[model samples]
Structure formats: C-alpha cells, structure tokens
Target: MIYFLRNVDDKITQTNFRKALTIGEISGNVLMDLSVMADEVIGPLLCNPENQKGWPKIVQNDMKRHVNELRNLMHQLKGEMSSQIMLPMPEGVENIYHAEARLKESDSEDVDLYLKTNIEGAIIKWAQQIYDLLQEDSYIAFKRTKFPLPISDIEFYTHRLRNLEGIYSQLRDPRVKRMAHYLESTRSVYLACFKSMLTNVVAALLREVCNLVIQQCTNSVDPMSIFQGDADEQLIKLRKAMGVLNHFIDTYEMNRDKVHTFFPPGVMPVRWSFDFDRVFMRFNTFMKRLKMIDNIVEATVEILKLEKVEFSGLRGKILSTECIKVLEEYTLIYQNLGNITYDPADPEDTRFLSDYDKHMAVLEDVDRRLASLFSQGLDECHDLEHFFKFFQIIGDLYHRPIIKNELKPKVAKLLDFMHSNLDAVKEIFDEEMAKLNPKGVERPMVDPYLPPYDMNRLNRAISWYNAIREGSHETEVALIEKEISAIDHLLGRGVEELTWNDDFTEWMAEVYAAINTLQERVLTAQNNVRRGLSNIAAWGDKPLHNRKDNPEKLELLAVNERHPRLVARRNKILQSHAEFLHILKDNYKLFFNIKEDEESDDEEEELEEVDESTMDEDERLARAQKLQAIMEQWEAKRIAREERERERAEIAQAKFERREARRLKREAKEAEKRERQARRDEG
Candidate 1:
C-alpha cells in the first residue's frame, strides 16, 4: 500500500492535476489515504488481531515494512508544503480514521502519530538548512578571490530547489507549502545579489589598475628633460607600465566566462571607463613629445652644415681674420649645443635657433657688401677727384675688421698708378719750360714786357697737381702723401729757377731813360713853334705903324724869319718819339711774335695825314700873312723913291725958267743988252 501511495504521489506531481484542484482539496484527497492506511490496515495488523490466526514471523515483518514506508512517504510530502499549505483530512475521512483508531486502541495507533509528527519536523529543518547554505555560498563567491565558489555550487543549490518544488506539489499541508514558496522567493533574491556583487568586484579591480597606470604616467619626469639624459631609460619605464596594463587585459580575457556568468551580455561597469581614456591620452602625449625631440635634432644638424658653405663672389676668396674668428666661435657654440640631445619643444632652445639663423643672415649680408666693394676698378671713375672720393669711402668701409684683410695690395696698385700720372705731368712741365728758355741760362729778373708763355702752362699744371694733392690729403691715406710732397717740391724748384737775363735788363733801363729825355725836348720845341706862328698871324691883321716908333714889331718879324731853325727842331723831336714806339713794338714781337697788319698801318697813316694837314693849314696862313706884310713894306719904299725924283726935276725946271727970265730982262737992258743974249741974242 505504501508503494502504491508513492507511485500515486509521483503521478500527481508529474501531471497537471494541481491546476484543477484547490490546495485544501489536494491536501485532503491526496495525503489522507496515507494516514487511513497506517491507522486501519497496517497498525492493527502490527498490533495482533483477534478473529484471525496469529501471523507468522515473515508476515509480521512485511506489515512493519509497509508501516515504515508509509511514514517516510508522508514525511517527504509534508516537507514540500509545510510552510505553504494547511494540512487537513476530508470531512468524513478523519472521522473514519479516528473510528478505525478507536477500534484499534492499542499502542500501534500512538506509534503512528509519533512517527508522522517527527517526519514533518525533520522536513522543515532540512529546507531551512538548504536556504541558509545558498546565502553562504553567494557571499563567499563575492567577497573572496582565493578559493572562490565555482559555477557548480550555484547549480547544486538550484537542483535542490527543483526537488523541493516537486515535493511541495504533492503535499497536503498548508504550512509546508508556504515554507517552499518562501524558500523559492529567497533563492531569487540571493541570485540577484550575487550578480550585483560580481559586477562590483570586477569594476573595483579595474578602477584600481587604472589608478595605478594614471599615477605612473603622471609621476614621470618633465617631457623636455627626457631628451637631456638617457631617453631609452624613460621609454623602458613607460613600456613596463604598459606591460602591466596589458597583463591586466590578458587576465580579464582569460576569465571572461566567469565574469559573464554574473553579468549580462554587453553590460560593463561604468566606474573604470575613465581610466581607459586617461591611459590613451597619456600615450598620445608621450608620442608628441618624442616627435618634438626628433624635429629639434634635425634642425641642429642642418645648422651644423653651415660651416662648409661657400659664398658666390670675391667675398668668398678674401676671408678676413675677424670673419674667421666669428666662424670659429660659431662652430664652438654649435659643438657645445650639439653634444646634448636637447628638447626641440623647449622655448629657450627654439629662441636660440632663431637667433642663430638671424646671425647667419647678417654674415651673408656682410659678405655681399664686401664683394661689391671690389667689383669696380678706379679707372671707371669720371675724374681724379671723383676717383679719390670713391676710393676714400670704399677704403673706410674695407678698413673694418670684417673686411680689412688683403687691402694693402690694392692700395699699392693705386699708388703705382698715381706715380705714373705724376711723372707724365712733370714731363709736361719741363717741356713747356724748355719752350720759354731752351738754354736754361741764369737771368737777373723777369721781363715785365716779355713775360714767358711757359708760365701759363706751368700754372695749369700746378692747378692739376694741387687738386689731386688736396683730394688725397682729405682722405688721409698715408700711401699717397709721399708722391704729393715730391710733386710739390718739383713745382717750387721750377718757380724759383725762372728768371730774366742781366744784359737785357740793363739795355731796357738805358732805352727808357733816353725816351724820357727826348720827350722833354720835343715838348719845349712844340711850344716855341706855336708862339712864332701866332706872332706872324698878328702881323698880317694889323695896319702899318711908324717905322721908328714900332721897332719891337720889326724885331718879331726878324725872329719869324728864322722858320728853318724851328722846322729843324720839330723834326728832331718827332724822330725821337718814333724811335721810342719802335722799341716797344720790338719787345712785344720778341715775346708774342705778333706782326703789325698793313690795313691797320694804313688807317694810322690816314690819321697822321689828317693831323699834318691841320698843322700845315695853320703854318701856311702864318707864312702868307708874313709875305703880305713884307710886300706892303717894299711898296712904301718904292713910292718914297718916286716922290723924291719928281721933286728934283721940278727944282731944275724952275731954276732954268728963273734964269731965262733974268736973261730976258737983261736983254732989254743989254740987247736989250745982248738980245736978250741971242733971242735976247735974236730978239
């Protein structure tokens, strides 16, 4: 009967009958049969019945085995529903079992009740123990890494809960049923707590690892300083830190299944996410610093290349000592800087590079300026003055330390050119002087009238020499001074040597003295001639006066009659003046070789003719007046002679008449006395 009941319970639990029956009905109908069988059949048989013969040992043992089996089946069913449902028999079933128990009011009935209550108590205790174990396993799995509970542990707990569910379906007790449902609810809550604990553990571990990596990266030395020392050492430290991070990742991958058992798919904890961003950001920063160092090194190498660079012109050929020194200093600076693998990112280093570039540009500009200074030659200049000024300016520029080397040779060439020009000028001076005085004889003084033409040429040469000397002096160049002084000495010697001849000076003095004396005599003669002409003119205008009383006028006429002596005195004075003019013309001709033109001589003769004609007219008038005076005087003399002759004849005629009258008177007396002596005589 117990086997039958066990089979019936298994069938009811496996089937869907619990959906159709109420908890009270299931308890009453299903579980009451076990109690009835124990009280009516098995209990009386085991206590020894009266109407039947006494059982054998085998039959008694069989009845006891059935009773024990019934008790065990009731215990398992009670444990399934003790906390879930209240246990009660059907309305008449309990009374039927109680009447059966009364009929068998022996020790057997008491024994059955004791066993049923003991099994129910044992079922409730086991269920509570299993629930407590689940809680403990979940806590151990979450809190400790060492000896953590495996997934099988959770599986074992889930298997026990399923068995309990099956038992609860068969049980007729409300208390046991309530206990099963409560354990099921507790199991769900513990599972949720276990999943949450796992997520927290993983997230906390990730946070700790990320924090360590962040600390390592942040605590490293400055990025620029890394280039100053051993760069590999710093890189190794970074690699080690990265290795630690990689190990953590590997560990996570290895245990991915264990973590996923608690956490759902695609659900990562939020706490450790920022650490990943920090790690990547630090890595990028480190890479950028490395690139900066590379760029700085490249620029340094480029700067070092400048030591071998060559300029394109004369500046390259002539290297000044100062420029060489500057280059050496630059090389030293580059070496000092090149030894270190400095950080290009450093602002101070960047500034140094910039300054170096600028200095190099300045050097190149200086080179070009020096090259330009030597490109043109001195001969290209317009004149000596222009060339001198240009040379001075360029010389001053080249005299600087950066451009001073190799300058002396150029200056020497210029001096040689000046010497040649000076020699040429000196030769010209000597040739011109030779033209003036070929014999180079000594003289007393320079002739005033016959000044040498060579002097004018010498003046022009001196002007040229002085211009060059003055320009050279302004430059203050020592090289040109010696030549200038030599030229100056030559000029002085030429001036001092120029002189006139002694004989020529004396002859000119004598000639001048003679001309002065002749001028005085000529002036005196001219005054006397004018006075004589005036007296002759007065004599022609005046009437005749008494000869005896005007004896002074008559004396003037005698003086005027001496015209031949006045004319001879005038001609001598004029001839002396003409000789003085001829001497002057000869002196002019000797110096300048000038000849008088015939046309000019003719014009002079015409002017002389007009002057002589004026003088002749005056002289002729005076002579004509003198001749008229003389004629008037001669006429008076002739008239006086004629008058005296007429008077004598009259005297003779009167005497003869008087004598004849006397004769006639006497003839009257005597011829009248001789008849009148013939008349007187004839009469």
Candidate 2:
C-alpha cells in the first residue's frame, strides 16, 4: 500500500512537471515554426523573383492577410504560456509584434536591432528545445552548466523577451507596424493556449509530489518497509525543494518585471545574457534533490517507528553535506571579491579603490544582509510564537490551556481590541458621571470609601486586571460579554460613588454652616479677650504702651534689679514653652500614648499662675530674684554643653588625621620594599 501510494504521488508530481515541460515545449515549438515559416517559406515567397514581380500589385492585400495569421498564432501562444505559474504575469509576454518588427526593420527602431540579434538564436533553440524538454532528464546549457530544461532557460528567455519592449515602441514604418500588429495578435493567442497547459502541468505535478511525500512519510513507520529507508532524507528533500521553489518565485518576479514594460531597454539583448540561468538551474536541481531526499527521509522515519530501526548517522549526513559547504563557499567567494576600506586622509588610495571596493563590498555586505534577513525571519517566527504563548497564557486565565491552544490567538486578539479601546470605556464612564447634580443640605463632605488603602497595591491590582482584559487568550463571545458587563457594573458603581449629588451637596452645606457659626463665635470671643487684656496691664493702672519711656535706653542702663529679673523670667518661660511645644508636637505620635481624652485632662491639671491684675510689689521682687537665679544656672549649663561638643569634634578630627598618616606611612614602606626587591633582582 505504501509503495502504491508513493508511486501514485510521484506520478502526480512528475505529471505536473511534465505539463510545465510541455508548455515550454509547445511554446518553443511554435517559435521554431514561425521562424522556419518566415525564413524558408514567407521570406522566400516575398523575396522570390517571380513572386516579387507580382508582389507590388498584390502586396497590400496579401501581406496584411499573411501577417495577420502569424500575429494571431503568436498572441495565442503568449497568452497560454503566461498562465501556468502562480506569480505576477508581466505585459506582452505572449506578444510577438516586437519580434516581427525586428525582422522587417522597416523602421529604424532599436527594438529591431535587439530582435535581429536575438531572433535567430531564439528561433533555433525554440525549435530544438521541444524535443529536448520531452526527454526525461534533459537539461539546458546555462552559463556552461547543464541544468534542467524549461525550468532553467524559460525564465531567462522570458526576461530577455520582456526587456525588448522599449525597442518595440519607436518603430514608424508601415511594414514594421503591420508586422508588430500581427505579432501582437499572434502572441496573445499563444499565451492563452500555453497558460492553460502550464496550469494543468504545475497543479498535477505538485499534487503527485505531495501525495508521494505523504506516503513515504507514512511508510517509514515499518523497520523493514524498504531496504534502504531514511526518513530524515525525506524531510531534508522537502526543505530543499521548498527553498528552490522560493528561489524560483523570486527569479520569476525578476523576469516578470522585464516583461511588463513597453519601452524597457535598448541593450536588452546583451543584458539578457546575465539572466538568472544559473539560479534557475540550481533551483531545479534543488527541487529534484529535495523531493528525492524527502522521500528517503519519510521512508526512514517510517521504518524507525516500526520496531526500532537502528538508523542513526544515515539520516542528517546527506542533508548536512552541501548546505554547509555551499554556505562556506559562497562566503569565501564573496570575501575574495575584496576587502573594503575608507579613510578621509587617503584620497588617492580611496579614489582608486572606490568602485572596485564598492562592488566587492556589496558582496561582503550581502553576507551580513542575508544573515540579518535570516535573523529577522527567525525573530518574526519567534515573535509569532511568543504571541501564541501569550495567547496561551490568556487562554489559561479563561479556559484550559491544552483545549484552548487553537483558540488562544483569538482570545489574544479580543484582549488587544479591548485594550486598544480602553479610553472609550473611560469616556463612557465619564459621560455617566457628568449626569449627577449637587446642591443644598448639610452632611459629611468626605467620602466613606477611602482612597485605595495602598496605592501601589491598587496599581498592581489594576495592572493584573488590565493584563487579563488585554491578554491574548481566545475568549468566548459569551465570556467577553460577561466580562464587559462586569466592567460596566463596576464603572457604573464607581461613577455613582464619585459623582457629586444631592447628598454630597447637603453634607457640604452642613459643614460650611457649622464652620461659619464657629468662626463668628471665635471672632466675638477674641474681641472680648483682647478688650479685657487691654484693660489689665502688667505695668499697673496705666496702659502699658503709654507708661513705657525710653525702653531701649532703660534696657541699656537698667539699675532696677527687679526689671531685669522680670525680663529674664519672661524669656525663660517663653523659650521653655516653645521648646516643649516643638518636642511634643513634632513626631508627637512616637511619644507616650496619650489619648485625646487624656490630653484634655492633662491640660486642665497643668499649673496656674497669679494674673497680671493681682500682682503685689513684694511678690514681683521675689519672683524677679528667683528668675535671676534660674537664668544664671541655665546660661552656665548651656556654655558647658557647647564646650564639650567642640572638644568631641576636635578629638574625632585628630583620630581621622592619625589614621590617614598611618595609612600613608604603610604605603610608603610597601613601595620602598618593592623598590629594594626590584634592585636586588636586577643585580
């Protein structure tokens, strides 16, 4: 069964290749036919003596008629040939108007020169290639290398032919114009016919190859399935073929560009020589080798699966052979091209080496460029994988990871959508909040729900929520709806809680009313206290301000011992009160745990002194004496403390200086020892 499947698959791939081969064959044959007909029959007829004699009379009608037929055929073939490949089709690939114009050269168009140069060789090969393409293993001679036919040469020819468009447009002669018109018509017909054939051939071949590969892969399960089975070979082959296909696609595009233009290049004939013939051959060889390797790999894989086939070194050996070698060889080839150097100071050397170095540099540059491209592709693949991993993470949040593996991407996409439009959600909430009103009545202005007790913790929670919402898990529509509903509910509650309303207005009003009442009472009481204090002065019955006389002069020569004593007592009390308030109020919470109620009691039980209105002369004298003593003691203590602090600082500085000196001395000794050791060694 496996053999049958593999055979069937191979047949399909071969069939498709054969179809492409046939298209190339048929197109090649038609060109050959036209050339032969033009050369042997048409040219001879037009040039013959007897025919020439009668030609002038019948020329107008007969020439047009004859040309029309050829034109029609050419167009048909060109059309047929273009439709085979799964790539962009360039303009006029099937058109031969340009080719015919070259032959007649009735006009001085440069395309005529290009066509004349190429037509003979082109026709000759076209005729020859039909049979060759039919051969099972025939290859074309491209750059001295015999690569597979159709695959190798066709693209190159297409490129050359398409590049001839520019030359085609400049022709002005009636005969050349007629020929162009005729060729175009024929090209269209040819293209249409060829495309159908190519499409069929390619489709059939790929189908066959895929089937064969699949079979080989399956068959490799049995150890004794095939005598020399190697499954790894199959995988390698598949990869190679895939690579070649990629290369071919690129080359095809390059050729297509040439074909799409009307006025392409005057020197197309010469430039065409540089067509990707080698690339195409390599591609073909790679394709064939890949398919063959894929078969081997698949077969071996199957065998290994069945009863432990001891196939080890046999696998990757062949796959690894040319890849590394090719990479290295290509690298060396580019490197030998030249080294690149540029210096602002060396103009002469720079000038001589510029172009050569530039070209060589391109070769070297391509290595990094290619490596970068490879890395970029890998990075893209990795990014895609990471995207999928993120999707899996999101999936884990909602559904089982294993089950949601396929849907993870979908969920991730949903999260991305939500995140992208999060502002919209905020906008909606803002609109909802704006609808609330606040006016009239007394109540607490402060909110009951405090700011999130911990901002960092809140922010972290928000981040987690945002991550969940923005993640890439394949969330079910229902689940997303539910989440959205939940968010809406929270948003609504948040808006209601935050928005100012009737209750908030009432609370604010009440607070303001109470504050106004307290403020009025405080102002009245302060006025009364000020008045009472103003009426009773420490200087006795007279107002204190009126009684004061030359206070500064009195301060300078104060002979009244009581006055000085009183001033000292006043200053000490003020200083102690200020210090006590500072020490208690600043970082007060760290001190004793005096509750608000206990604090009130303590304030009530604090000492009371005689009022300024009730002071006696003897009592004042006694108080002044006590104050003087206290002031002297405090002054002496303060001076002593300052002296101690200064001494301590000086000691610290001395210690630092001594340590530094010792370190310097030790360093000097080490240096001296090293110098002495060096001298001894020298001796």
What is each predicted model's overall lDDT from 0 to 1? 0.45, 0.42
Instruction: Give the deviation of candidate 2 from the true structure as CA RMSD.
Output: 37.3
Write model 1 residue lDDT over 1-683, tens digit each, in one string: 22222323344554655553444322444566665666676656664545235777677556555565565556556645543221222212223344334435653333333323333444444445434433443444455455655775565445444444443343425543333333233343333332333333344335344544544544564443533444345555545554665676667556653654666678863332223433344433443444444443333333333344333333443433333444565556534543445543333344435534554555455544444443333334434454565455454445444444534444555666687789998897776666675466643344587853334444444454544445433433243455446445544533443234222232233333433333333333334445545644444344333233354665534454356646655565566556546544553332232335422332331111234355677776876676677667556656765776799799768746754654565455544545445664454
**Per-residue lDDT of 1-683 in model 2, one digit per residue for the tens?**
01121222344565465443333223445555665665467645754566656457467446544554454455445444652211111222233455555545745433443233233333333323322332322133455474556655556444433422211222223433443354343343333333333333333333334334433433432212222323455355446546655664676568756753534567343223323333244334434443433433343333233221111133323323432443455445434332334321121233424443444344344334333322222223223344444333222222322323434344455455556468777886676566544663433333566552334543444554454445423432233454445444544543444333222333233333433433333334335445444533433343212223474655543345656667765675576556546544522422223346445433432223767467788878877777777667666656866886799899768746754665576677779999999999999
Going through the candidates in the order shown, the clash numbers are 37, 67
Give candidate 1's total backbone clashes.
37
Specify the poorest-scoring 10-residue window by lDDT in model 1. Answer: 85-94
Evaluate model 1: give its lDDT.
0.45
RMSD in order of candidates: 61.6, 37.3
Q: What is residue 255's positional error in candidate 2, in angstroms? A: 6.0
Query: lDDT, candidate 1, residue 549?
Result: 38
